[model samples]
Target chain A: MKLYNYFRSSASFRVRIALELKGLRYEYAPVHLARGDHKLPDYAAVSATALVPTLELDGGERLGQSMAIIEYLDETHPEPPLLPSDALGRARVRALAQLVSCDIHPLNNLRVLKYLVRELKVEEEAKNTWYRHWVREGLQAYERELAQLPPSTYSYGPTPSLADCCLVPQVFNGQRFNVDFSGLPRTMAAFDACMKLPAFQQAQPSNCPDNEA
Target chain B: MKLYNYFRSSASFRVRIALELKGLRYEYAPVHLARGDHKLPDYAAVSATALVPTLELDGGERLGQSMAIIEYLDETHPEPPLLPSDALGRARVRALAQLVSCDIHPLNNLRVLKYLVRELKVEEEAKNTWYRHWVREGLQAYERELAQLPPSTYSYGPTPSLADCCLVPQVFNGQRFNVDFSGLPRTMAAFDACMKLPAFQQAQPSNCPDNEA
Candidate 1:
């Protein structure tokens, strides 16, 4: 298996944490988003959208989208499941994951930021404001949901499930953009707990082979 | 089961289509998004984020996120599955769905549009441009992926899968924004095919109880 990834991509980070948590071994194929490596023909042939975090299986099947790839891994691996056994629990975990992946991250992603700065010519400060705004709104919802559950090591349960896979990355990006975290005690607590685990720590952007700084 | 949904919401439309496809009976509890009904205390108690399309199960278990709700419905229902039988096929379908749900719809949704016009003071025409840009980019990816599959009745196969559930709503929104659909032959074809079905047609915004205009 090989994963075409980028160090700074929150979506790539989500898949990397999932791979590490499941103890899956795969070649690291970095697609440098900053350098436009993903837009090159070699990467474009493998990923239709020229996006990072395309997991190519041993059988030559490729999977795009972080959540989809993570779900595929959980289904095939089975042990240390990323989702809960019960349907309702699974729904909650998935909802939390989508809250970050869909509602927050996509709006502030690299492409969207580029469009804002280049096409719309949005000011730098306003761009950062855009990033922070979405992050705060997303984490606020996540924090509320986490507060509903009893305090645990991870988002939905004691074990780090799919929500943690998503949460840790969003928090990483949030801190980069200097989003306010003071009100999100539970979310920050969950992030801190997940970061303590080797899987998440090893999957950080700074730890990746293509880390710039 | 009861669904708290807003007629014009693409996310709510996705779940409604899924429910119809499964032949399940669900009471439609419309939350008028444009009127700010979702922010009211009653709806907020059900959906912490005050987002449309919150599904309350027979036992009163609440589920949020349209994709998660649809997946939960698939898991418990399981007759005509939303995902393919093969894991790889399932992954493909999910990636296609996320390309729209995460990449396109969230970026141009009512809240984000409101932010652009109200908070950022972006003009209406510029806001529509932003909407069209994201929709075009997202659908370009979708069309590329769909082109890879053998000619079929739906996005993935003869049967309408989860990707179609996501696609039809996106195309509906794209048309509303007057996005250029000329380059997307496959995607438009899939949309046309999907619209032929009663499930897609009946779940449309015009058919909904809360549809204002």
Candidate 2:
């Protein structure tokens, strides 16, 4: 499998973590979004939506959307389950994942912030304000949910599931923007614990081939 | 089961389609998002995130997030399966669903749009531009995928599964905004066919209890 990824993309970061967690070997094909490489014709053919983190397979299968790609990998290799076994438990994990993936992260993606500055003519400080507002609101809800778990170490259970995959990347992005995770003690705690694992630590944006910094 | 819903919310509409498709019996508990009803104490207790369409099971199990709730319903009641039996097929269907759920719809949701116009001081034309920009991009991908299918009346196959559940709401919202559907004839055809089904027809926002206008 070949994953067309961008280093700073939280969506791609989440996929890398999932792949690492599942112990799958894949080639990384970095598409630098910051450099407009993702918009090139060659990369555009692999992904119709023109988004980074497109997973192309050995058998000519191409997949997009980080959550969908993660689920695909989970289905193909079930060793480290992306989801829980039980129905309700699976729902909880998925809801937690979506809370960040769908609700929070999408609002603060690089493209969105760029749109605020370019299209909407918003100032730089206002753009960061917008990012922090959604991040804070989202982390507040996440902290509320995470603090209620029996153990505050992980998002849901002992093993890192979908929630942790989303949390680690989101926290990384949060820190990049200086969103101040100081208030989200439970969320920061879980994120810290998840990053200690090899899979999570190795999937950091800095570890990617296209890391600008 | 009791579904905490708002009639016009696309997320809640998706759950209604799933429940109606599965022939599940449940009481409707409406949460009016426009009137600050969802911010009330009782609703806050059920969903810490204060989002609509939280499914409360008969056994007192509470669930949040639309896709997760739909997955739970599918798992518990397997007669009309929402996901494909095969993993790749499931991934494709989910990708199609997420194209709208994650990418297009969230940006145009009432709260997000409200934030743009209110907090960011983006003009109405810019907000509408933002909405159509995403909807057009998403529908282009959706149309391509729909065309990839073997000329079926539906998005994937004959039966309306996960993809159709997502397609109908987005198309409805898209049409409401006067977005052009001519380019997406494949998706338009599938949307037309899905609306004929009782499950899809009944799940229309106008069919709900508190459906205004």
Candidate 3:
């Protein structure tokens, strides 16, 4: 298997965490988003969306979308499940994951930020403010949901489920912009717990071969 | 079951299609997003995120996030499965679904559009352009993926999978903003096929109780 991804992409970070959690081995194939490598024809051939974190199976089947890729990995390698066994529990975990993947990360990803600046002519501070606003809002929602659920070590349970896979990366990216983390206890606690795991540590942006600074 | 949603919300429409497809009866509890009903305490008690399309089960377990809610419904009631039986097939269907759910719809949702005008001070025309741009880009990506796969009656196969549930609503929402649908033959073909179904017809925004001109 081979994974084509950017080191700093939260979506990419998500798949990487899942891979490491499953102890799956894959060749690292980096597509640097900032360098416009993802826009090249070569990368487009690998991904229809020309996005990062596309997992190519050994059989030559390629999968796109970080959430889909993570779920695929979890299904194919199910010793340590990324989702709860029960349907309702699965729904709760997935909802928490989407709180980050669908709501927060999409608004602040590299492409949308570029559009805000290049197309909308948004100033730098406003763009950062936009990023922080969505992150804060999303994490607060996440925290609220967690408060309703029974307490657990990770986002869903004693194990790191899909929700933690998503929350950790969003928190990591939000830290870059100094997004306020004071009020979001459960969300941050999940992030903190995830970082303590070897799998998450191995999958973090700083540990990637293409990491900057 | 009860669905707390607003008519014309694409995410709400996605879940509605799933319920209709599965022949599950659910109460239509409308939450007027435009009138700020979602922000009220009553709605917030039902959904931590205060987002529309929350599914309240018979046991009073409310599920948030359209994708999560649809998957939960598919799991609990699997007459017409929303996902493919195989893992790889499921991944492909999910990727197609996420193309709209995560990439396009999130960027152009009501709150994001409101943020553009209220926070960024983007003009109405510019906001509309932003809406159209993401829709076109996302659908083009969806078309490309579909082109690579074996031609099917729906987004994945003979049945309307999760992909079609997502695509039809996105195309419907795009049309409101006059998004260009030309050159997306496969994407439009799938949407056309989906519309022919009675399930899709019954779930459309115009058929909803709260739908307005």
DockQ of each: 0.84, 0.80, 0.92
Per-residue alpha-carbon lDDT of model 2 for A1-213, expressed as tens digits?
A: 899998899989989999999988889998878878887899867887788788988898888888889989887899888788899889988888988988898888877878888888999999898888888899998987776567745788888888888888888888888997777887888888898899987889888777877
**Which candidate, 1 or 3, has the higher DockQ?**
3
Docking class of 1: high
- Off by more than 4 A, model 1: none
Best prediction by lDDT: 3
TM-score of each: 0.98, 0.97, 0.99
DockQ of 3: 0.92
Instruction: Using DockQ as the measure, name the better of candidate 2 and candidate 3.
Output: 3
Tell me the deviation in Å of residue A121 in model 3. 0.8
Query: Residue-pair clashes per candidate, as listed?
Result: 0, 0, 0
Q: What is the C-alpha lDDT of each candidate?
A: 0.91, 0.86, 0.93
Please write out the lDDT profile of model 1 over residues A1-213, one tens digit for every residue: 899999999999999999999999989998888889989999889999878789999999889999999999999998789999998899999999999999999988899999888877789999999899999988998888787777787898889999999999999899898899988887888898998899998999999998997
lDDT of 3 at B106: 96
Better of 1 and 3 by TM-score: 3
Ranking, TM-score, top scorer first = 3, 1, 2
Off by over 4 Å in 2: none
